[model samples]
Target: MQRRTRQQLRISLLIVAIAAGLGAVFGLAIAGAGDGDGETRAYARAALRGVWTGGLIAGLLTAWEYIYVNRPAGLWVRRLTFLGNVGVRSLIYLAAIMLSIWSGATVFSIEGADPFGWNAQTVIQVGFSVLFSIGVNFAMAINGLLGQAVFLNFLTGRYHRPVVENRVLLFADLVGSTAIAERIGDLGFHGFLNDVYRDLSAPVIELGGVIHKYVGDEMIVSWPDTAAGRSRALQCGIEFHALLAAAEARYKNTHGAAPALRIGIHAGPVVIGEMGDVRQEIVFLGDAMNTASRLVDMCRTLGRPLLVSEALRDAEPSEDGPALEPMGETGVRGKTRPVAVYAPAP
Candidate 1:
């Protein structure tokens, strides 16, 4: 704010100096008009003085507009836009002042010591008009820009922090990850993991889901509402299945056994927020996430790559997702009632 203010102040002072210079130039031109003859010289001088006085005042008004409009607070001023608004308001004031002066000089013919007479009434009226226009413009401009800035920030990833909400959640982890990492080694393993993330991100993003975080060989993702959220969770399973198949083919040629992965999806609300003080990360909270984690843990028990809840299957069965089969009801640690489980089709 201070920087912007200083910049505006400097510009204003510079304009004032320039206005003074212009006025002086006009005065000199008038003085030199009649080859220094007494009568012609006096008329030239008076005309120069009149024009310079008007020009100086107009220039000052323009300078003020420029300075004020560019200020941070000016965004709220409707009549004033951002920096561009300064120029706009300046032009409006300039035109209005010129019209007022012209009208007074032509109609009233108020003759003073100079050919062009100073009409206090015209100046006052135009001055007020300029002020009124600027004030109104400034207010409108600021209000509109504030909203624009917010959306712009969101679109540009400036406000990347996520909001936590109750919803379905999924946690996918790579099985035999440690063995695979050892085979690929650290550097190559990092690349391999990045490739998996890149491949997985598109489907999630397309379905309006957000990637929560990566936990070593595991990744957690969430969707917005329950239905759409479950859709994304299921879609992720299908995509991950297909993607892993393709990756397996490549791995067979390059290395040995295809790396296996397990995915567990649970439907429920979870608190989401940017976690960690050093590098803020979007994370999930609530039993939903915990349930999802446990479901993935159950993958070891069932010897399956993917498992989902009946709630997810019921939400959108025909939608894009892995072909699933009922796995019967099973008791989970936290819940008293037995939960229905489904295995994702290979």
Candidate 2:
């Protein structure tokens, strides 16, 4: 989890630095009226100071979310302690950062001390800073770590026109979801599935997988095929199993049932682009996505918790490579060619 936090911290720092730098440039440009270049120089110094001060605060806030709010384990752990950690962390950050900022302003005239700043202006600015920190972090928490990558592409129109990309996809479905739902009732099932999604995210993100989408009880994760191979997507599935197994006692106590996960992996080309007029979104469309889903469905029929296609599976550096057993080629719903399936060796 510390490693996960460190990975997320890099993204947080990048987002905050860009935001603060842009804010500085625009703020200075607008205020560059009187004193000519002297005022510009002042703002430049302020901008650099602001970068360190604001960036440090942002880093702390991101780590707080990882330790107490954003992570799956954090969510449940906080739940047990009545979310006391959430309240405690929130207050500590608020007091500590504001005091630090106020001190930096008074002693060092940090950020040029926000010339002509009023109490209301300071309050509003701090409010916006808080909102920006929460928004960016949660966006990454809800979306994938590559959220900025996708959004940056959308902004640059890099994906405005469709482009073919080779990606490895892993589709996972919660086995016996219907039966579990029936026993737990709709309301209870909602919470159970929420837990499942939250739990699944840690392994996927930690392993460098980006979530493509979540469809009802199914989750689709993607990565560049080359990166996927290097990251060992196969181990991710096995890791998920080990994770759930380790949490079995907790799952039973909290949800009153233990759930099984079935996952399938495949790799090929997909059309990636930004879509929609009113609100833009990144979309992936191609047989690769569908084939991954179908292979996941095959998990139930084939009686394996994990499966991979020949295209995605590979011989590792280990003496025995990956622990994969052949499931042979099978017909897929949307493709002319049958996909070769392999299950992990038990």
Candidate 3:
């Protein structure tokens, strides 16, 4: 779609430039055959010269705008294109002013004009005026192009943050998912997983959490700032458990094993930013992400449906927030000392 729009603009600009070039040539021919009044002929020659130069410059600028505005992968590419156009257009404007001066000097003899104090100064004034006109148009073009780049990027969903720092992180997965898959058909098991995800993600987003990534039946989300991150993390834990409970209730009525979910939550500072060249990705990095993933493993080992760390529980949550139950301290791999743990109340 973008390519087609660009192609159309290019063709249109080419046609317009050709038409303007033809008009400029015809106007020049008429000026050259004017009646022999020296002053009248000189002024007519200068005016015709300025018109031709202005039209040519305008045509070139229009073509450049088509390329800079139309062909690009993203906003950054468009920005560079804009800067390049400014440089190119400035050069073209300089050339046009120079041409205008030469035509003015040739049509009115410098020695004759100097006796009336209208020699170098007069030529300089004409050049300055012409250059000023071109500069004004160039400045306006630059501003318009930059503004459009900002607006287009905003509308295209390309400006969303890749990562959020100081967030509480949550990881959740269906327990014994492989066994369930073996028992129920793949399609039925996948349907069940999708249902769980749909319900689980809603409250997280509502609580100012970003859904990071989903791995099979498991998902990752983060809340910005340590306190809010943990608070939302615990909310996600409690809500997901409830979501699973409702699903299980329906499953029992259908003679299937109750689907269970294991959750882990941790709060800490994590790096959040855009990453990738060709295919960019937003990701979370730091000990917090590792800790959250490890906590998920702890939930599996302890046979707990959901787990939260001491750091997470200590963080203040919103009034009327769900309660957390102490799970005592446990030493996990990569930790030198035991870390306190808690579970969301059922």
Order candidates by TM-score, high to low: 2, 1, 3
Query: What do the candidate models score in CA lDDT, each in turn?
Result: 0.64, 0.69, 0.63
Candidate number with greatest TM-score? 2
- 177-210 per-residue lDDT for model 1 (tens digits): 7887888788878767766765665556456566
Residue-by-residue lDDT tens digits, candidate 2, 165-260 = 998887888888999999988998888887877787777777778777778998878878884352457766777777888888888899887877
Show pairs that collide, candidate 2: none
Q: Each candidate's TM vs. the true structure?
A: 0.50, 0.73, 0.49
Estimate, for each residue in 179-296, the C-alpha lDDT of model 3 and write its tens digit. Answer: 8878877987876676566566556645657677787878887766565566767766776776767777777555366777788888877876556678655556888888888889
Error of 2 at 194 (Å): 1.1
- Top candidate, metric lDDT: 2
lDDT winner between candidates 2 and 3: 2
